[model samples]
Structures are given as structure tokens and as C-alpha cells.
Target: MSRHDFYENIRNSTRLNHFANLVNLAAIDGDIKPIEEKLLKRFSRKFDVSEENYEKILENPASFPVHAINLKTQRLEFLFDLLRIVYVDNKMDEAEEFLIRKYAVGLGFSEEQALVVINKSKKLFENNFSFDFYQHFIESDED
Candidate 1:
């Protein structure tokens, strides 16, 4: 394959892994709810995952390994996507919370940082949680 095609494949693989993570989170509560499925479909589209691959991921998300995102912005966006799935039903359960924390670590956050992000996200998601606001909150801690 050409260099461009090679890089594209790697990027697509990473996106597939990320999408699998979302699928796993959605199914963590035993069955995937209708609302959760809707959100998952939307995410698949955003991630550029094909319908065939989407179904395959849903069949067994655990098969995909967690790929650590390099960019801070990407990591936060990853966390935000997880939070979106957790809150899609208008509630956050223990399983969802636990999975999200694990995912945060996989996305390169420390355990403590995961807790902080999850706790703060729970509150922010309940209000008007925009990515801009969430990014500001996280970055503000560095100053």
C-alpha cells in the first residue's frame, strides 16, 4: 500500500477501536437500549465505521484492544463520547460509571484524573455541558 493508504488504515483501525469501546459501554448494562443504539449509530457514522464493521463490533467489542489517544483534545473527546453514552438514558448507573473510568485510563488519564473527570462530567452533563466548557474546566486546572 502507498504511504497515504497505510496511514489511513492505521487511522481507521484506531477509529474502529474507539467505536468498539463505545459499543462495549452501551452494552454494559446487559442489553443495549433503543436510545443507546441510536447514539451508537450516530457515533459509528461520526467515526466513519462502516455498517458491516459496526455490527461486527457490536457482536463482540471486547475483541478490540484499547488504543491510547495521543492528543489531550482527542482524549477528552473520547471521554466526552463515553459520557454521552452513559447519560443518553438520562441516568448513569454503576456499570456505566465503572466502564467509563476504565476507559478514561485506557485513553491515558490517571486513575485520579479519571475520577475527577467523571465526577465533574456527571455534574456538568446534568447542566449544559458543552465541549468548550468541559475543555475549559480541564485546562483551567493546569493554570
Candidate 2:
């Protein structure tokens, strides 16, 4: 794929979410277990990403470090939104935690910055308790 296509693919796929990639990675413990295979397949199918790209992602974990940095530069709300989706059901496994740390460090964020990011995610969870409420607030709020 061209460099542009590679970036576009990452941007369009759920794998763009570092947290989601972490969750997916957590599901597989080095081997391609059946359930993990199923989950990956489902994610690929849903995102219209080809198996080749998925394989590339698995083979090279740091290929998207720049993308992770870009995500970090975004507003805290966007970051927390991603974290919330990844940590849905209120649990983050070891693999997910590992990925988050790796990406944060790669983005050149200090330990304090990383902690602040996690704290921001927690605050997001507290501030936006429901979809309807968030929708109402987002629509009404100027700030």
C-alpha cells in the first residue's frame, strides 16, 4: 500500500484507537486462539480493513506510534472518548494497560502527563454519565 493508503487505513479502522488495539491484543496471548481470531476477524469485517493490514499491524506494533502521538495532541475529550470505548464494562486487562503505557511513553508524554491523561478519562466517565445527557449537554454547551 502507498504511505497515504496505509495512513488512511489506520485512520478509518477501529485499530486507530490505541485502546481498542490494546484490547484486541489482550485477547490473544501470543498464539492465534480461535476466539481471538474470531474477534479480530469481526473487527476487520466491521471496519472494512483487509487481513493483510491486520497482519501488518500484528507483525509491527510500533508502526503507528506517530498516530498515537497525534491522538494525544487532540483534546482530552477525544482521548477520553477513546479510552471509554476501549475500557467499556469498566475493566482494563494487563495487555490493554501495557499497550496504553507503551503508547503514552512513545508519544513522549511524561509519567505525570500519562497519569493526567488517565485522570482525564476518569473525569470524562464521571462527567458524561449517559448518552442522552452527554448529547443534551454537548448540544447546549458552548465550551
Candidate 3:
């Protein structure tokens, strides 16, 4: 395959893995609420996940492997998306928190970093701020 095509395939695979992670989070509480389902559908569209693949992922999200995002910005973006699903019901449960932490580590965060990020993200989401605001706050410490 061409270099460009190879890169595109990797990008697509990463998106699919991210989408599966979101699905896993949404269903972690034992039931996917209507609001959560709506958000998941929107995310699936954004990720360019076809209906068939979407269904397949929903059936068994854990079957997919986590793809580590190399860029810090992209990793934070993925974490933000996961946080959105967690807060969709207007409350964060223990299962959701644990799953998000696991995802954060899978996204290349150290355990300590994941704890800090997840705690800060919970507070930020409580304020109902935009992703831009969250991104700025999370990356503000960078030189």
C-alpha cells in the first residue's frame, strides 16, 4: 500500500478503537441510557464508523485493542470524548471513573497523570464548560 494509504488506515483504526472505548464507557453502568445512545451515535458518525461496525463494536467493545495516541493533544481530545460520555447522564459513577482512568493510561498517561487528569476533568465537566476550555486548561502547563 502507498504510504498515504497506510497512514490513513492507521488513523481510521485509531478512530474505531476510540469509538469502541466510548461505547464501553457508555455501557459500563449496565445500561446505556437514551441520552448516552444519542451521544454514541453522534460520535460514531464523527468517527466515520459505519452502522455495521458500530453494531459490532456495541456487541463487544472489549474485543478491540486500545491504540495509544502519540500526540498529547490527541490523547487529551480522546479523554475529553470519554469524559463526555461519562457525564452524559449528569452524574459520574464509580464504574465510569475507573474505566476512564484505564483509558487515560491506555492513551499514554502514567497512572499518576491519569488520576490527576480524571479528577480535574470531573471538576471541569461539573462546570459544563466547552472542550476548548478543557483543552486549554489541561495543556496550559506545557512549556
Candidate 4:
């Protein structure tokens, strides 16, 4: 494989792993709702997760690695993605919050920082900022 292809594979793998982890979190709340399943399917397509790979992930979600994306923008994007997933069904349980907190750390934010980021992201969403528009808010305020 070319170097670019290799890196692309790594990035795709990282996305798939994180996606699976989020699904695992969703399942933790007893049952996976229809909306959650639909969002999961959409995310799988976005991540280029193959049917076989998704099946493997479903079989053993713990096997996937939560590899960090190096760029802050991408990491924040992932955080927002997680927020969207957990809240798509219009519900945010403690289990979902706990899982996102774990992901925040995995995304390179400290425990305290993660809470702040997550809350900010949630508020941004509440204000009708979709993911595409939300990045502008974060990017414009880089310290």
C-alpha cells in the first residue's frame, strides 16, 4: 500500500473503533432504540465500516481501540459526533454521559476539561448549531 493509503486505513480504523465504542455505550442503556440504530448505520457508512467489520465490532466491541485523532478540530468533531449520537433519541442517561466522559479522555482531554468541552458542545447543539456550523464556533475561538 502507498503511504497515503496506509494512513487512510489507520484513520478509518480509528473511526470504526470509536463508532463501535459509542454503539456499545448506547446498548448499555437496556435497548437500542430505532433512532439510535438508524444513526449507527449512518455513522458506519460515514466511517466506511464494512459489513464484516461492523459485525465483528458488534460481536466484540471491547476489541476495538479508541485511537486519538491528533488534530484538535477533528477531536472536537468527534466529541460533537458522540454528543449527537447519545442524544439523537432525545435522551441522555447517566450511562451515556459516562461513556462520553471516557471518550473525552480518549480524545486527549483531561477529565475536568472533558466535562467543560462536553457541556459547551451540548449547549452549542441546544442553540441549533449543527456539526458543520458548530466547528466554526470552536475554531473561531482558539486560544
Candidate 5:
């Protein structure tokens, strides 16, 4: 396949299949935090992949099997991953934005497309967590 075809595959993969690898790698030094782990688990279930597979991915970062296993749609996910990582600490910084944007360009998005992908990823993450905030709120009300 052409290089374009190759990368396109990466852009279209399900968030679960490949994103687990991305998230896990970023967390190795303790950055994942609990909330991130929750989201990663959700993605794992969503794609029918297991947490076991996630661990495997962590053991071998260089291969990135998700790219070869199924790529027709994940480069976008990868770009979003960078965006998510930038926001992992709860806010975006210039360095994070620049890194994701530059990486997006390499993955084949124009500025506009890259922005859209980034924005969507942001939105996805914004709503990704399913905390028991409501429960906490109700409990607080009891006080």
C-alpha cells in the first residue's frame, strides 16, 4: 500500500485498539492518574480488547501493533492521544499544543483538520470520565 494508505489506517482505528498503548506509555512514570486509567479501561471495553493486551503494548512500544493489526483509521486517534496527554494534567500548554499540532501535520492533517481532531479529542476526554460526582453532590447536600 502507499504511505498515505498506511497512515490513513492508523487514523481510523477504534479508540480502544490503539489508544490503550498511547495512554499506558504516557503513564509509565506515574502520569496516568486514576481518572486516566478509568478512561483507558473504558476504551479497552469499547474496542473489545482486554486490559491484558494493554499491558502487552506497554512492554513493546516500538512495534505499535495496533498500527499493523488494523490501521485504516487511527492516526486521528493517535493525534487525539497527544492532545489528551497534554491535558492529562488538567490543562493545555503551548508546548503541548505545539507538539500535538506538529505531530498532526506529520500524520496528514492540515491545520484545520488537525484542529478539528484535537477539539474532538478534547471533547471526548472532557466527557470521558464518569465520576460519581452526582453521588458526591447528593452526599454533600446531606451535610
Candidate 6:
């Protein structure tokens, strides 16, 4: 494959893995609720996750590796996407919150910063914030 295609594949894999991790959080209560399943299907289509890959991920999500995103803005965007996943079911449990915090830290935020971001993200969800809002907010913060 071409270099760009190669990197794109890797990025797609990472995103799929991350989404799988979020789905795992929803299933932590020993079952995936209907809402959670709907969100999973939505995310799978958004991420271009194939049926074969979906089955693989469902079979064993924890086995997937975490891949790093290099850019700060991209990392923030990634965290926001994870928050969206968490909020999709309209029920953010303690387990989901814990997993999000852990993923945020893994993405390079401090524990305190992660919590702050999570809170901000929750508000964004409540306020029906769009991707443009997130982009503008991040840009304004950099100024």
C-alpha cells in the first residue's frame, strides 16, 4: 500500500479500537443495552468498521492495542469523540467515567485535566454542541 494509505489504515484501526473500548465500558454492567447497541452500530459505520472487523472486535475488544495520535488538537478531538460515545446511551455509569478518564490520561492529559475535560465534554453534550463548536472552542483556547 502507499504510505498515506498505510497510515490511514493504522489510524482507522486505532479509532476502531478506541470505539471498541468505549463499547466495552457500556457492556461492563454485563449486558449491552439497546441504546448502547445502536450507538455501537452508528460508530461502526462512522468508523468504516467492516462486518468481519466488527465481529472480531466484538469477540475480543480488550485484545486491541491503543495507538497514539500525535497532534494535540487531534488528541483532544479523539477525547471528545470518546465522550460522545459515553453520552450516547444517556447513562454515564461510574465504569464508563473511569474508562474515559483512563483513556484521556493515556492520550496525554493529566488526571486533573482529564476530569476537567470530561466535565466540559458532558456539558457540551447537554448543550448539543457540534463539531464546529468544538473546533472553534479549541482554536479560541489556543489564542
Clashes of each: 0, 0, 0, 0, 14, 0
**lDDT per residue (tens digit) for residues 1-143 in model 5:** 99999886665454443454445344545555665566555545544556677776545544553232133145644544444445555665553454455456556666776665555455445544432332232224232
User: Please, what are the lDDT tens digits per residue for candidate 3 over residues 58-135?
Assistant: 888767757777888888988886677556656667655765787798888999888888877876887677778998
What's the C-alpha lDDT at position 7 in model 4? 94
Error of 5 at 122 (Å): 3.0
The candidate with the higher TM-score, 4 or 5, is: 4
Among residues 3 or more apart in sequence or in different chains, the pairs in candidate 6 whose N, CA or C atoms overlap within 3 Å are none
lDDT of each: 0.76, 0.50, 0.77, 0.69, 0.50, 0.69
Give each model a TM-score: 0.59, 0.45, 0.59, 0.56, 0.37, 0.56
Model 2 C-alpha lDDT per residue in residues 63-128, reported as the tens digit of each score: 444333454334333444455554554555554444455445445566766655554444445433
- Per-residue lDDT, model 4, residue 143, is 30
Candidate 3 segments whose C-alpha is farther than 4 A from its true place = 1-19, 22-55, 58-63, 141-143
The CA-based lDDT of model 5 is what?
0.50
Model 1 clash pairs are none
Writing each residue's lDDT as its tens digit, candidate 4 over 1-143 gives: 99999998877766776788766755655576777666666657655679988777766665664666788888888887667655565556654566677788777777987787766665565444667777776555543
Candidate 2, residue 129: the lDDT equals 72
**Candidate of highest lDDT:** 3
For candidate 4, the TM-score is: 0.56
